[model samples]
Each structure stands twice: as C-alpha cells, then as structure tokens.
Target: MVKEAGLGAMEKPNHKHVADSDLISPAKKAKKSEEAGCDTEDPKIPSGAEDEKQEISGGEEAIAAVGDRAAEEESSSCVSEEKKGFLIEAAAAEDRGGRQTMEDVWVVLPDASLDFPGKLRCAHFAIYDGHGGRLAAEYAKKHLHLNVLTAGLPRELMDVKVAKKAILEGGWKDGATAVCVWIVDQKVFVANIGDAKAVLARSSSASELGNHTEASCNPLKAIVLTREHKAIYPQERSRIQKSGGAVSSNGRLQGRLEVSRAFGDRQFKKFGVTATPDIHAFELTERENFMILGCDGLWEVFGTSDAVGFVQKLLKEGLSVSTISRRLVKEAAKERHCKDNCTAIVIVFKRE
Candidate 1:
C-alpha cells in the first residue's frame, strides 16, 4: 500500500444545486425548462427534443404537460441503460450480517476516436471502498467522475495530483475512498482516493498466440493512488491518536476502520489530513493491459497482485469480464463466509 503524510483538510464540493433529500419530481423539470426558455411550440421545431422556443404564452398548465412528457422519456432512458452491460451485482450472503453493504458503481466509456488516436483508446474504470457504511462507496461512485471533469482535463493529459486535489476539495463524502482510471490521449491516468486499487494485467503475447501455454498474465508496472488509512503507518497512527482516537487490537483503529484517509467519515475529519484521499497519477506502458478497480471485499480474498493474476486466468479461460467480476465477489464470500460485502469492477483493454 502507498503511504503519505497528511495533505490537510479538503473543502466539500458545493451542493447548492442538489437538494438535501433524494427524491426528484417531474414538476421540478418544467420549472427548470421554463427558466431555460421553452416558450413557443412551433411545428417546424423538432418534436420530442429540447427546442429553444422564442415565446411561450401558456402558464403552469402548458409547462406541466411538457415537463411530464420529458420526465417519462428520461425515466424510460434510465431503465434501458440499467438493462444493458451496466451491471450491479451483489451477493447478499455477506451483506446480511455485516456493516458493509457492498454498494459500488462502475461505468465503461466507449472508445471514441475524435479525442485521441493510436492504441491509447482505452476504457475508464473505478472502484469505491466504503466502510462504516455503504454511504461513502455509493457517494464516490456517483460523484467521482464529476470531480475529474471539474478538475479541468489535466491539460494535455490527466493529472492525478490535480484530480486528487479536486476530489479532496471536490465535495465527495467525508470518509469515502475512491480509485478512478481513464485514458487520455495515448496515456492512461489512474487516481486513487483511499484503499481501493487499480491494477493492469497484460497477456504474454497475442502475436505468438500459437506457442504460449495457458497464456501467462502478469501485473504491469502500475500506480497506487489512495493509500490505506491505517495504524501501520506511523504518521497515520499519530494522526489518529492525536485526534482523540486509539488503535485497536486488530491493527485497525478503534476495533474497526482501516486507513486514515477517507472522503466522508466526519468523525475523523477533526484530525485534519487523516481523513482525505491520497491521489496518484501514472502513465501506462504497452505491457500494461486490463485493469481492476475493486474494494476491500476482493482484497480480503486476494492480494493486489494476485487478484490481477486470477482475473487474467479467468479471461484466458474465456470467462466474460463481467462474469469474472461477479465471481471475484462470489468466491471471496464462499472462502471466508464473510459478512463484509464483496464487490469488484474489471476493465478489459483491447487494441483499437
């Protein structure tokens, strides 16, 4: 695991637009549209599309009707995406008895060439490690991308340091930990917030496909961003004790909670940098292949390097990427009969 000194307190992202609660209503949509300028209902204007109407004479009645229709379309589109490869797999076996809910999110961006060229076209991947509850993990999955985008495109490429700064200052939860990876230009930028890890698995040789036995896969030179917030690191322990907390017999703090850097644990924020994410960025080499973004659930079963190897074997055996991810959780639960939720996300990088 990577280790580092405290980077100090990170400012929370602005939630001025997001309401205190979760529920979203259709009426809210119409009001927003009306504010944006949807006045006229000209036939020549595109139907079922957002049109800039010059003037709308109708009052609440017309706005409500238009908004209701838009809301229905939006809801339908959401359901369709959920049905696709956007998989949310959870083996309830573990979550039943533990504090971990195993709520994680993953998004795969399709390779588009307008932005970059060459073999660099790659998929984006992320994994959030939540503890104390699934709130942090869930929050990270939902907002980590917005943090990166807001961080300002890292200029010619993704800057992990800048992204991490954005995350810390970007308004993610107080104790949540996150790891995100995306491809920019011809290079791969991987950033971590807490303990969640990202690893690249490379195939031995596709050109010599005829001779390789079982297709060897190895962990490529990679970067670890989010460091574990634990007592093993002297500085972390110091930060914890200084902040009025004590180390536990289990090597974790206070009988629970590992790693000192997290996004949303308000309790730990009093200790300063002990509660922020450590962001690291690195460019990948040709040997760098598929990458894995997983939580402590999978790590509980496999080492960072070993997990990558297991995934490689699964792929060689013709297991689908999603299947391998699900199996990672399944096998982990089966091995230890764990009550901690097991979750994982795997990204397979292919040449374009």
Candidate 2:
C-alpha cells in the first residue's frame, strides 16, 4: 500500500478564460522551453540563453478514473493483487535555483473519479518551464487538462485526433514548455513539447524496490519519453527557414529564442514557434517501476539513467515520494548548481 500524490482537487477557476496549454507540445501547442531562460533544450532549458524562454507548464484533469490509492491500500475487495498492483502513486517538487523568477508549474491528478464519475482507473501528471515569463506556465497548470477532458478523451484507446484537438483548442499566451502523462487502466499516454521530459524506469526482470539484491540483478532502465524541440534540429530548422525564421550559429530562433516551438510568443508564431505536442500511448507492464517528469533545469544536472538510479536507491531505502522529488530539485539547484528553476514529478507503480 503506497501513499499516492493527490496535491488537491482539480478545481477549475470561476472565470471562463478560453485560453492556455504549455509545458509540452506538437502542432497542438509547442511548449517552448522557457525555464532555463530558453527552451527545454537548455535544462539550463526545455535549451539557450536567458533571452531564450524556457518554460515548463503542466495541468492535468481526469477524463476517466478508477479507485484511489488509499482505498486500494486499505481495501479487502475481491480485486486481485495483480489488478491492484497497477494502481499508482505520484508526487512533485520544485526549486527556484539561481533564476530571478521561478517559472515552472506542475500538477498531479491521482484519480479524476470525483470529477468525471467513472469506474475506470486513471492518473495524470504534468510539468512546465517558462522562459520570458511565468504567466504562460501558470495558465497551463490550471486549464490544459480540463480542456482535454472536455474534448472527449477516449477511455479504451487514445484517439489522436481527439487528444490533439484538445491541445489545439487550448489557446495560450506567452511561452513555456510542457510534459504530461495520463494513465487509463494499463495504458499510458505521454504528451510533450520543448525540454520538459518524461522518463520511465523499466526493468528487464521483476525487481522489487524492497530488495536491493534482486533489484541489482534487474536494474531499472531509463527510457526517455519526450523529444526536445529546439531551433538547431534539422527538421525544426527546415520548418523555421521555410517560415522565414533564421537559426543562428548559437542555435536560437532569430538569434533570440532557442526553442523552435512554444505556447505563446505570437511574435515568433510566424517564425516557427508552435505549441503542438508529440503524443504517445503504450501499455503499462510489470517491467515499469516508475516515471519521472522534469523541467530543463533539473535535467541540466541529471542524466536520465542517473536520475533513475538515484530514485531507485532511495526507494529501496524507503524514502517518501515527496522527498525523492524534493531531493531531485535540491540536488539540481544546490549540489549541481543548476542555473534555472528546477521542477520534478515522480510516479511509482505499486508492486504489491
């Protein structure tokens, strides 16, 4: 029975603002990395200089849901252990580091059952990094997920059209990069833009976090789930040049913004910055131990494998999920001297 990360209710604001989605992208909303003062390309981004906005934004709502973790941990229902084992626990943490403003926002939705009224099990997590400003990041942290819900998220399968449409309809301003995850039953869907990234800790063999000896034999494998959209990539460069934008030698759009895609920056909209997200869906299996979502600042100091190993060691030592996330931020800001806002989310699959 693991403690789940449910920061609070997925409360929508009273205001009807028909706008926003960041922290991640596609043509849906290319969340440009803004936290590293650039795009997710920097970790120093979501990549480049302070002039380059690096924003990580995350907002999640449950279009569907199953049961909560506390209930599962305390229940004696007929649900088999194998079925119960798929329930998830999550947590998030943040650090400002040396940045003048903290521009990363994130959300955790353990079960959307209360809002959606469903028997299906679902969970969501997201993170955002803002570059020029934090407004864009903050906005996405509240509305993007709700928009996805309203757009009709498919329960049995991921309707790319439906999901992508949700993001497309989600209007945004300013700039930020996003990374998000939605879990429905055993299916996992990941959506992202910029440098904010999602990584999965997988194992070739069943390795209990409680058993280091066994865990060592079946070391967790780090699998990066998001792709960074910067001005330097050939694909992005092609688009930028076609859009009449130039990628300077330093690898920034117009010698100013480094991320080729973003939520806002209407100024760059004509130049190639977009907010569309790259979405992926896959099955969750016993081989997956946990997942991680982080803004560029955190990645600036931690490699995917290094982060997985660190979290695995701590899980074996029985550290709290919140603590693990906090440590990730603190380590990046204090120990590794990351120069931007650091934010992270940790989601662990129940193995019991």
Candidate 3:
C-alpha cells in the first residue's frame, strides 16, 4: 500500500486576515517579479544548489523576509506557439469538512494571455490542496495564475520554481500543496510543490488504432510528472534533519506536517520547509492522450498507473473528460473512502 501523509486536525484562522492583501491586486502581486530583481530576458532558473540561504524569523516578518530573498533569485523563460487543437475539461468534488467541503482549489485557462497582443493558444491547469486552513490554497487559486501571466506567459511558465517562491513570499500564514500543467504549442510543462500531483497519459500506437475497441488499441501509460515531497523520500528526510527538524517514525515532518515542502506554513519555514517547485517539460506527440492533476486525497487511493489506466478505460468507452473528472472524485470519496477533501482536473488533447 502507498503510504501518504495524513491531514491532522488544525484550527481554522480568519481567511480575510491571512490573504486579503495578496488577493486584492493580482497584477501587483505578480509585478513583484520586477521588484525582486528578476530578469525578464532569461527565464531559466539555476539549479537547486544555488538557492539562497534564508534567515529565520516569526509571524509576518518571516514571510516578508522569504519574499525578499525569492525576488533576488527569480528568473523567467518563454515557449513557442503553434495552432491550437485541444479540448480542455475540469471538474471537482469535495468531501464533507464541517461547515464546508472546500479546501481544494483549481484553475483552467484555455486562452491565457501572453506578453504579446494575441493570446497564447495554450492551456493552464492547476490544483491547490490546503492543509490546516483554506487561506493559502484559496489565495493561490486567485493570484498564482495572475502572477504567472504578469511575469509573462510561456517564458515564466517554465520558471515554476520562481513562481512558487513568489507565492510563498506573498504573505500566506498557512501551507498548501500545488500542482500545475501548462500546454503550449507542442510542448507540455509541469511544476509542483509538496505532494499534489500531475500525471500524463501517452500512447505511441494510439494513432494506428482507428476504433475504440480495447483489443485493437494501444494501451495508455502513466507518466508521473512531479515527485512527491514527503518525509519518506530520502533527500527530503535528510534536508529536514540538517535543518534541525525531526521526521517521525511514521514519516512525517517534525511528526507534524506530512509534506516536507509547501506554500505558507510559516511555523515550519525555519525547519527547512520550502515552496520551491520541481519543473519538467515534455514535447507533445501523436501518442499523447490527456493529463490529470489531483490532490493527495485521490492519489492516496490510486497509484499513478492505476489512475491513468482507469481514465484510459473510460476514454475507450467514449466518456467525456468532464464526466471522467467528476467520476474520479466521486469514486475516491465513495468507493475508496478518501477521508480528506478531493479534487481533480482533466485536460484532453483531441487527435485530429
């Protein structure tokens, strides 16, 4: 069985007090790219070894300090464009959580704007899974995309590490996991922090099979795009130990948070927790089918291959992307009995 970090009990704080300033001016929040001394010309960020050392503090002051450091190390990049021929779809279902079944947030931008006049004929999908409270996730859902757009599309999209750093520095008091995918031209870019994940379905022989018959068609394979930042991972465990944080015998950060990296979580910043994201780029081909982004709630119940194969089976039956997404969440909640809030976004690339 796949071991995942459990969402422990946490007190909900005032959302307005936590994220009001960051959400009001989405453009302004993103514009900080300039103030951070980020270069608009080059978007490729240097490797992790060069990450700046941040000072430890408390409350809002710590958040401000991290933001200041993130700005100085930030960079941007752009992507080429081709005619768009894709169908995008997304849906999410929530498990009961007291007064609300909320805590999960997603964004879909089929016609996202680029630095130039004509919009980039690409699509962007993201999922933010909040822990403790919804303020950080809710704030990221509203402003992270805008920040990506403001820093310049395509180019900045590839610089997800810097973008995530910016979001963390944006004054969030809680923490949340994030996973996002950007489809541009014939390439797909994926970036993620913490455990929320993105998976791609690819089939080299898909074009050869004309019909949906299972026997005649090539099987779709799951390609996990992002690595989970859990304490069980050796590198993550080492990093926490070096930073004076302890990993429990059950594999949790300081025997508290399950994830080693996340947005917000001001309390854990001093213990080596970060918001840096892992970014990967893939060239699109005829074999490509679709992609899925979901929180740990879904992954805990389904492995990467299991989820991808289920979606492929549904596609063979000619089910729509929207229907597949809704069914995925429902199954996880009901059939698998996922205890946490669940959400998923599916983007299908139609072959013509």
Candidate 4:
C-alpha cells in the first residue's frame, strides 16, 4: 500500500474571532514554509545580489523577510486590518488504494495578506494537479509561491520554458500541472499546467453583492488559467498522432495523456510530446468574488459554473474556505462512489 500523506485533523480557528491563532506575522509564516515537511524550500532570488545578502542576517532570515514587508505595506497603505473581510480556507483528504498510490498534494500559501484592512481588495491563490505520482504536485505546491516571490522571472516566462526544457531533456520527472493566481499592478494573472483549474466568480445579483452594487445580477465569468496538454484537443491530438503516437479512446493519443500539456511525464517525449505548461494571464474586474483550485477529481464531477455557484452559496451561508475544501472533497467522494482522495484550496475575495 502507498504511504498516504497522513490524515491528522487540520487546525482551524473559529471565523468569528478577531484574534485568530493561525494569524501570524508574515515573517513567522514564511519561516514555517521551511518546516512544511515536503522539502519545500524558500523562494529563490537572482544571482549576484550578494550585496543584498550582506544587508540581512542568515540566508534563511533573508528569505523569511522577502514578502514580509510586502504584506505590511499592503496592510497599512491599502487596507485596514479591522475592516479586512476576506478569508482563505483549504483542506486535503487521502485514500491510498486508488490511482497510483494517492500522491496528490495541496497547499494554501500563508495568510499574511489578512492584515490588509481595506475591504479585502486582493486575493492570491494556486492549485496544482499531480500526475505520474504526487512529487511533481508537491514540488509545485512548495515552489510556486517562491517562484512568484523570486526576484526575476523573465517577464515572458521565456526562462521558465527554457529551464523546463533542459530539465525534461535531461530526463527529469516533471509530471504535475500548476495553476497560480496573484494580483499585481491591479490585474490578475492566472498561470496553469495539466488539468488543475482556477475559477473566478462574479456577483450575479444585487442581493449576491450584499447591496454593494445596483446591478440586479452580477455575472460569473471564467478567467481561464492553465491550458491542458492532453492529446484530446484537436491541435494536440494531431501533434501526437503525427509524431507517431497512437491516439486512443476519446481522441487522447496513447489512451493515457488526457491533457494536451503538462509539467512532467518524460516518457511521452519519445513521441515528441514535451511536458510544457501553457500559461494564461489575464485581468479580472474588482467585482470578482471567489476562486477555487482543485484536482481533476472535482472537475470530473462539477462543471466550471456549477462549482462557482456551489461555493458562492456556501460563502453566503458564512462558510470558510477550509470548510468549503472539505465539503468539496466529500461531495466528490460521494459522486464518484469510491474512496478517491480529494483535495482543494479556496480563496474568498471580498471588497473592503
């Protein structure tokens, strides 16, 4: 049997409290990253910044401080902590017997931003889908934030693609799809891989908006995140078949690669199938309400709109993200009629 990621109950604080125990200064939260037990490391900075390194104490302290000030400035400058009204909740459940030893992993980035006081103006979130095993998913969970926080990614991800190519060509196991969202320069960029999905909800009614707007129904729009690498998409399927791999049931080449793009799965390269992620970047209006990061287990059962609706209802009833995550998994387990491991992280975005 595969060793599961343990089932110990996650600690959550009551939502009604002003002082949540989970609430810690951003610096302390960053330090906890090193202790998350997944060999997940701190965000990497650019080379030749030795002068900046000297400005700080230990290397670990430098990393712990990277995004700490960002959180504070955003709080004192943009929003007030007392009026801050957004919540992020996450949950994971594991079942050992199904689908390659249950290697799926999920994480919620530290809630340092809760310090922002204005009407919860920004939300950052991510979802990773693991394949071939859970290592790739776990790797992304640990590294995605660091990558974003890291000083210099080529503005176009040209370096990201180049590095990925080098890693795969050298025969690395990069088989997870990642979808990440962060608010910068007043717009939202959602980047993705594999089939893991990120969804946005727009208020549909004045009632839904808590009387914030006069519009009768707020619209829910899907801000597309990562593109899939399965062979089923016509262009991708054609590429696989043309490359000499057989397209099997449902138009997927080789019957197994359901997505047209992915982060790992090196064996597919023989047919010239490269494990590259298709990143989608876009802006969402400030009215955007909520976002969800879930594995295919949820997608296999819920439509994009259906999920947004379900979560919106839950939030209206005063549920936290952690509660939402648990319910989503429970719902999937029920619908699938199996002991499938399900994990989810949800971010509820609100106006201050």
Best by lDDT: 2
Tell me the tens digit of each residue's lDDT in model 2 across 54-136: 22232221110001011111011011112345657677776666654445666777764337644456566877666654455
The C-alpha lDDT values of all candidates are 0.41, 0.59, 0.54, 0.41
Give the root-mean-square deviation of each candidate in angstroms. Answer: 18.2, 11.2, 11.4, 16.0
Instruction: List, residue by residue over 1-352, the lDDT tens digit for candidate 4.
Output: 1122331221221111012222211111211121111112222212222111111010110011101000000000011111233323333333321332344454444332343333223344555554433445445555555543442322232333332222222211244555555543234445454556666555533244432233223435443343444566666677777788876665544654555555444445566455443333333334556566665556666666676666666665666555565566556655554333344566655544
Question: Order the candidates by TM-score, highest first — what do you get?
Answer: 2, 3, 4, 1
Score every model by TM-score: 0.58, 0.73, 0.70, 0.59
lDDT of 3 by residue, 236-298 (tens): 889888989888786766666677777666566688776666556556666566777887777
When 3 and 4 are scored with TM-score, the better candidate is: 3
For candidate 1, the per-residue lDDT at 211 reads 17
Clashes of each: 16, 64, 5, 23
What is the TM-score (0 to 1) of candidate 4?
0.59
By TM-score, the best candidate is: 2
Candidate 4 lDDT score relative to the true structure: 0.41
Stretches > 4 Å off in candidate 3: 1-82, 89-100, 114-119, 155-174, 206-216
Worst 10 residues of 2 by lDDT: 64-73
Query: Global CA lDDT of candidate 2, please?
Result: 0.59
By TM-score, is 1 or 4 better?
4
